[model samples]
Target: MTKPIEVRNPRTGKFDYVIIPQSPKLLSQQCHRLRRGQIQWQELGIDGRIEALQQWKQALLSERDQLTEALINDTGRLSTSLLEIDSFFSTLDRWCHLAPQLLQDTAKNTSVPFIALQQTAVPYPLVGVISPWNFPLLLSTIDAIPALLAGCAVIVKPSELTPRFVAPLMTALNTIPHLREVLSFVEGAGQTGANLIECVDLICFTGSVETGRQVAVTAANNFIPAFLELGGKDPAIVLESADIDLATSAILWGSVVNTGQSCLSIERIYVAESIFADFYHQLVAKAHKLQLAYPALENGEIGPIISEKQAAIIRDHLQDAIAKGAVIHCGGKVEELSGGWWCRPTVITEVDHSMKVMTEETFGPIMPVMPFSTVEEAVDLANDSIYGLSAAVFAESAELALEVASQLDAGAISINDAGLTAIMHEGEKNAFKFSGLGGSRMGADGIKRFLRKKAYLIKTNASKDPWWFNEGESSKDI
Candidate 1:
């Protein structure tokens, strides 16, 4: 199944070079000896790993503009949105700085069979993180930083769209002497990616559920573990009690950030019907204030969609929503003029659960806004999606917002803010989601995903008489 792909660059409309590497079987066999505990936990501790990633961080900072530009070329994201890469770098640094303390080896006495029982959590070896291009640098690096800090090397299959940065990233990583050989990068088209997954102990995948499910299935078939960070139909709720100005800014940041390419992008915006028309009018008028420039400089506020195919998908979703009697309040066009992947910031009205725009993950700059009468209805509407990855709610009262936040079924919830869940739970004891399975790329989620616990029971007394002497067992030994 592993085959080479014919690569092309859309910017110049030219064909690129070919790349091939070891198959999944060979990679798996080679890694067989590199399991957890193969290396001492303290040998390559968090401090050392952080020291190395700091260099990686510096390299990322030094080339931030260039790297963002590369991602822009591939994803058609605004140059300004490219600061998202900077966000990733900062988060990586924060993870490196924080995770060592979180991953400290600790033991506990087990209450179960409370007889001289102990529970210990240890670091495992390398994990395979298959990150997607939508926000590839951030997603992959977010997971990788924690894993490395937890004493595991990572094998990353970066999205093919922005794979250009792999060499630069690996080069930067090489400066951290210890990780030069341990952390590795391998690139290939579709099947070659699958090969990489077949080998690693754990797989942290951030992509479509379809692809994520396949990764989990493939990993499971081989008895390997997997972390599936699939897509989301994230929703933003603007209540009757909301601050219009705050909601306006939050929605713009949540939806248009990265041209709405992010998994947590606010694809669904629900405003209380009492203020629906007013909010819709203001949101559209405010959007005009933001603009995308031509041959755009790096870090531009808006960028193109990743590809013509992605644009077409966005178009189809728009057209389908409209056909189903939904209304397009703002963007609905696919611009061929940019000679790049571009779709305007979209806002849809009169949407319902039946429309794909409402029910499925668009993963584009499409915001489908609707109105509800009560908090009960709004909460239900937001939780209607199969994807429970993230949500945002804006309310006037802190008490009411906290009450609502407690009720919403999401991995992360934002009160009076959007994408706040992306930052919350730092140093908190609780996991972000009742369902997201915890962790916000790092912190508790990072530790839970990367650390597997082993329970060890040691007898305080130097006797095994209890089990050995059962029903005349071991009589000959006595």
Candidate 2:
């Protein structure tokens, strides 16, 4: 028997939960069973699959309170935990509505008069998902739901850092026998995640670039596809003509929401030189109003740094920025309050890419603002990163905002707003650069990625093709 893994509570900073990873032999057996069950799952057809999913959704709804409480304890946040649950529900409904239309087979006439073309897709039998800790429940299921809709059996292994939610989630899954046969959640650390890649037909991972690189290599060695959603140092550009109030408000939320523990959060800010002073002043004022949800979860906008390792990274970035002569407008340090790590929406200025806070993925509520003399300079500064997940642009009008947004190197730019991709799933986008890999995990492609396309060419007539050799011709004849 493998020893159980101890889990840390983000709020109280105690090792309060434990999870035992499935033994390798047991994991292999589970994979074999799930693969065998996928045959029946696919045979159920789209309508049947949708029915089974909706049933599971209802089961999940019944366990909502328990799941919510578990997530709050898992992440040390209140409001975002509730939002995560709602997002999960909406994701189920959206995929159920979209899958049938997206997965329908197509038939059409070929260029050759006597031939017809029929196109269909087959789902890979088993899909493995390795999710991160920040938004434990939401990220874990983001790819799984669509894969299930596409008729793929899915196994998800959420991060060990936040495994408390798995118990309640499993309880919900147990109530739906049909879905239970094809879908499951395992609790484990990196080794288990690595083992999962070997057991599945495809893998989807959401985490740091370092780990994502390892997942990709393992998937390649195993001869399977790996869809990776990695880290980012996402940027936001504010124009001279932009509304200082609106821009600061939008950027503040984009930068510090969930205490900035998101890949799409605005870590770097570039403002037009003409309005740089006003922009920073208003941003500092808005950022100062935020509070850490420490003593009570309802006390403020910012939550405790969910991962202890992440808190250290935030601290290092702050120290590096200060040493390099960056000015902290407010909330500069990562503080420990009753053993929980917290940062209250830090806003910094006079920053550049020379500091780690500006160039690297801090993954905290640290916003470092810089000034740009021209549009060219702002665009250049924003594009000067190895990461390009998403970004934001603020201008006087939609047209102006879009103009700047068009030049960003990232996928999914928010015009006149920020982090719209977090709430809106209808628009399809790819994670550019080190942000991610494989097909878009939004819009129609989310489900389509699980399917492999096959084409059927049909001959309408029995006659042999004109290019074929004459039936009775000699081999040497020209």
Candidate 3:
């Protein structure tokens, strides 16, 4: 028997829950069952799949309270948990709405008069999704729902660090027997995730760059497709003509929301030299207003650092930045309050690419701001990192913002606002550099990634043409 893994409550920093990963034999059996069920699941067709998913959504809605509570316990935050639940529901609805149209088969006449083309796609039999702990429910299903809608059976393995939500989610899943046969949630750590890659036809992973690379390699060994959304050191550039108040507010929320524990978080900030002091001052003031959600999860805006390991990274980044002569205007340290690890929204200036906080994936509510004399310099600084997941650009006019955004190396860039990708899913974008690889997990590609396309080339007439072997003439004709 596998030993159970302990889970910590982010709010308390205590290991209060345990999850036992299924045995390798059991996991393989479950994969077999899901693969067998996938035939019927795919046969149900897109419309039928949509109906089953909608029913599952209803079942999940009934278990909403329990699921919400589990998520709150898992992540040690209230409002964000609620938002995660909402986002999961929205994702389900969005995929259900988009799948039918996106999955439709098409027939077209070819340039050759006697030929016609029929295009269609078949779903990958089984898809394995390994999601992160930051937004447990949302990230876990972000790929699963679309894959399910595309007629693929899905098995999700969420982070063992936050596995509490799996029970209620499974309960909801079980209510729809048809869906249950095709969709499952497995609880385990890295080994489980690696094992899952061997059992599925495709794998979708949302996590760190280090782990993502491992998943990619394992999936390659298994000869399966791997779609990864990895780490980010997303940067936000504030132009001189930008509104300091607007830029600061948007950048603050983008950098620190979810305690900056997101792949899309704007960790590095580059501002026009003219507004450098004012920008940092406004950012610090806003950072000070946010409080830790300690004792009570509702006490404040900032939540406890969700992972203890992540908390240590946050502390190390802060220490490195301070040691490197970065000036911390507010919230410089990670504090242990009532056994929970919390850091107030920290705003630092006098920072450069040399500091870990500026270049590394801090994954904390720490923002390092630097000044650039020219727009070109700002763009260069923002593009200096190994990560190019996403970024943002702020300017007085829409045209200027778009122009600046066009020069960035990141996948998704928000103009005038920040973290729009968190809410907006209609745009199709691919991660650049070490951020990630594979197709877009947004827009039409989300569901399409689960499918393999096939084309039927038809001859409109019965007569054999010039392209044939010409049996009668053969060598003599040549």
Candidate 4:
């Protein structure tokens, strides 16, 4: 049975107004069942999984405003920010269309040194997901679907602030009765998330690098391998080269989208020497054009920072950036909103790699742009972080852009694109380095990450590999 818990909607400055379900144990057991392989995703096939995801997608669309509002209340995100729903749809629709084919295994001749053989990577089951509140519905559900379709079950837990969104989620699951039993939600603080780490077979986490470190430590201690989609200090490198318009849009949307709460949002902008002043001017101008207020429960441009604590943390980072001599180009202070969580959209310039804003995940509506001279310098500047989640380059030449992409330490890079992450691309997922561990795009990566490989050997020549079994008798018998 699920029990209701009164939770605060920090954005609206309200408490006990919204009730969330807390089912930590039941959620744990469902995950245990998935680990035991009682679930059958193979039977569902790609089409079936696709259909189910579509249903969920439709449900999200139907409840988009409510979900957005809840997230805004929780995070102080802007109303217009939920526009990530576009990318969310892109990812889900694409997954429904492509995950099965992409995730399917390829049989191959092993061509082992001594004998005729076959080799293939098989899909394993069940991935546990721990989602944060920034883009609550999309990240939570998209990460869950691929695993389920890969013949794995999922146990998902959203960050506490937006837990209220799950009620509508439960309603969406009504059509997929089988999944309703396997796909579960448990709402609480870090304890609930930590408990899930022990319960599931594998994990997929998207949140702060600090918390991600704790999860990693625990998972590592248990020898429980999992994926971490942690944090980002992604940079946008603009060469005097290219399309000013394209570069500007990329940087603006990439960094400030969702009020700069996005992991791959352009945390840093490196403009070419020639265009630095122009780009900075245009960028700041665009920042001013943005309509900022408390996020409307539905269509507002942005929302709150999830909680006062997160807002405070973001504030601290901003203050530190200012102290370090970084320029605050736009909205810098916390704003009081009526019935919603809110933060002013922010922009920063004159930041270097050493500043906290450039190193840590501020996760607020803030952007810090820097400038560099050459392609070589740009690459060095972009790769100078502990984070390698995602990066982008804006240059006229495709060859140079690809070259820069090859050199950067990041797991994913966008050519001629700014902060607009391609996470929902037809056959991909968010890339990572310090951002997270072990993930890929399309269908192969995420679900596959949860899978483990066990190589099987058959000896027709009667030679035991000497690892365990006798060469002739044991090999022949088997």
Query: Which run of 10 residues does model 3 get worst, by summed lDDT?
Result: 469-478
**Model 2 TM-score, all chains together:** 0.99
Query: What would the per-residue lDDT of candidate 4 be over residues 352-462, giving only the tens digit for each residue?
Result: 877888877777777788888888898888878888888888788989788778898877778887553444443445555667776673445655564556454545566
TM-score list, all predictions: 0.87, 0.99, 0.98, 0.83
Clashes of each: 9, 0, 0, 31
Lowest lDDT 10-mer window, candidate 1? 429-438
Local accuracy of candidate 1 as per-residue lDDT tens digits, 2-53: 5655444434334453445557666665566345333643376678777777
lDDT of 1 at 365: 73
Name the 10 consecutive residues with the lowest summed lDDT in model 4: 419-428
- The regions of model 2 sitting more than 4 angstroms off are none
lDDT against the true structure, per candidate, is: 0.70, 0.93, 0.91, 0.70
Better of 1 and 3 by TM-score: 3
Which runs of model 1 end up more than 4 angstroms from their true locations?
A: 1-42, 59-69, 78-82, 107-119, 298-300, 423-440, 461-478
Residues 262-342 of candidate 2: C-alpha lDDT, one tens digit per residue:
998999999999999999999998888888886999998789999999999999999999999999989999889888898
Model 3 gets an lDDT of: 0.91
Off by over 4 Å in 3: 474-478
Q: List runs of model 4 lying over 4 Å from the truth.
A: 1-6, 17-37, 40-90, 103-125, 294-300, 339-341, 426-433, 441-443, 453-478
**Candidate 1 positional error at 101, Å:** 2.3
For candidate 1, list the clashing residue pairs, or say none: 76-304, 77-303, 78-302, 78-303, 79-299, 79-300, 80-299, 80-300, 439-445
Error of 1 at 118 (Å): 5.5
